[model samples]
Target: MATSPAAPRAASGGPVRLSAAPADVAALIMHEADLLDERALEAWLALFTRDALYWVPADHGDSDPLRRISLFYDDRSIMEDRVWRLGHPKMFSQNPPARQVRVLSAPMVEASGADTMSVRTKFVMFEHRLREQRTFGGVYLHELVRQQQEWMIRRKVVHLVNRDTVLWNIGVPI
Candidate 1:
């Protein structure tokens, strides 16, 4: 996608200069959700950089994933292992393969640098498995870097609305 040197309103309601347009940013985000919805785990993993970090903080206020307990704090290697396990035929947790659909709001460019951009988007994901349905809603904070002709995720933080509560099995990537 081509990017324009325009500023867009950030999630905090302030304008930030960015090399990417809101539409371009939203397109990347929507594509990621679509990949997950299609269960294209390998393709989804390809959206991140080699040193990517995926985090889901246990609490909304918690910072520093290293010092705080997180629902998930996975680096690229861990993500690779997870992708393998999720695809393994004998992975009991994914025996039936949970179905997921994610709805995301338009992405807002919160900040940007020469080769990187920070974005925030609200999301709601619905998962169905074992005859049960669960809904997860949250805000997603993404640090994206321009790689070649595409944007690759460097860090992704999922701030779940129910972060403080005990959650059911989230066998698949969120």
Candidate 2:
């Protein structure tokens, strides 16, 4: 069956313009990846805004952020705690740090609002120990904002392709 095209909706507001360049956005993303790969937790956390949120959703189709539990849902305070724990001598998990390598690719601009942009990117991360290398591949949805001539993360939502597996602790930031 053939269908006729619908008419375009009337403009409720003026067209939006993006002030940041694509190259700059890509550079910021690359820097973030580098920071994680280098295990620079403090520096990595600094890239987030004061009201930033870091989340790893528990299910693929789960959209209610308030009711559903998450793999991780951290604000600045929680993020600070995590950073402190990672470097604290009392943290047994840090005795032998889990080595990790993350590769972020195919970043595409998904949406753009007034002061925020939503980006989706594919990633492959390998967390390795003596003889085991656990690999995770998924897409990351980032809500970023421009602040003081720099782009900082407002929210980072990681969606792992596999949601039903019992996994080891993710001591390090994904």
Candidate 3:
């Protein structure tokens, strides 16, 4: 996994370089999508760092994740709860599990700071079940950290093009 030459110094007068392999980063995100599509919520949650945040903003570039309303804003505890409910027999939605397929485009590595790197990518997911099919397309913004030769998501922010539109339900991860 060879990296390109060091990026030009930042305007703030600091050297910027990415320590993680691009392919590795790409694979990590791809695997995450696969896990979600496969309904492996527990495995998917494990890929996040302890302090990780998962957010789907209701508005594009909403700035403040907390103050601004979001479709889904979850921490580790919340994610665990979601997984638990998803796995429970009482969870009516799972009586007929949703079928899903996700396609993630090649990741574009952005700014690098210390152990963290920002990534931007596009994705399209098709979810079908009970004779209904819903397609979702959006841009994903991820803050990733290199830990012991593996890249883990520190924060994930999804920006959907039609975020404000009323939807039937977004029960599953997008």
Candidate 4:
């Protein structure tokens, strides 16, 4: 990828510095959601570090993407291809692509460091197409890094409340 190299992951065992005011981190997340709702996949992709992950687990509280089934477990390349395919004119599921709207709550700082922060937020998204509208709710956990005064997502783990339910062609991102 032509994006900036991935910033090193903050050691999980390190002393985490939680921020009292994580508004900036929260704003970046909302902006990304806006980009997705606008179907600006490429621009949305740019908000991530080169080695970022976009994951959605199948089990209610699953943490291991490698050990179990998942709704999505996309690395940079897979994410890129997914965005490309979603925008392709020949994609039937998106023939008349659903319109998506996301409402994200204020972010709660979960963990932080000098260069990394994890924010958790609740989201309710509605995908509308034709005469149908499907509602999706979840918790969005983002691990973001500070690079040159910019906050970029290193990992986005979404735990959907309806993870086990049968969903339609989730052609659009949550």
TM-score of each: 0.87, 0.84, 0.85, 0.87
lDDT of 1 by residue, 1-174 (tens): 111212455689887454334677778889989999999999999999999999887876777889988888999999999999999999998789988999997787777778888887779999888998888888888889999968889988888886667686776778
In terms of lDDT, model 1 sits at 0.82
- Angstrom error at residue 108, model 2: 0.8
lDDT of each: 0.82, 0.75, 0.79, 0.80
Angstrom error of the Cα, residue 61, model 1: value is 0.9
Candidate 4 C-alpha lDDT tens digits along 8-88 = 234885544444436688789899999989999999999999999988877875767899888889999999899999988
Could you arrange the candidates by lDDT from highest to lowest? 1, 4, 3, 2
Instruction: Give, for candidate 3, the lowest lDDT window spanning 10 residues.
Output: 1-10
Q: Please give the clash total of every predicted structure, in order.
A: 0, 0, 0, 0
Lowest summed lDDT across 10 adjacent residues in model 1 is found at: 1-10
Pick the winner on lDDT between candidates 2 and 4.
4
Ten contiguous residues minimizing lDDT sum, candidate 2: 1-10
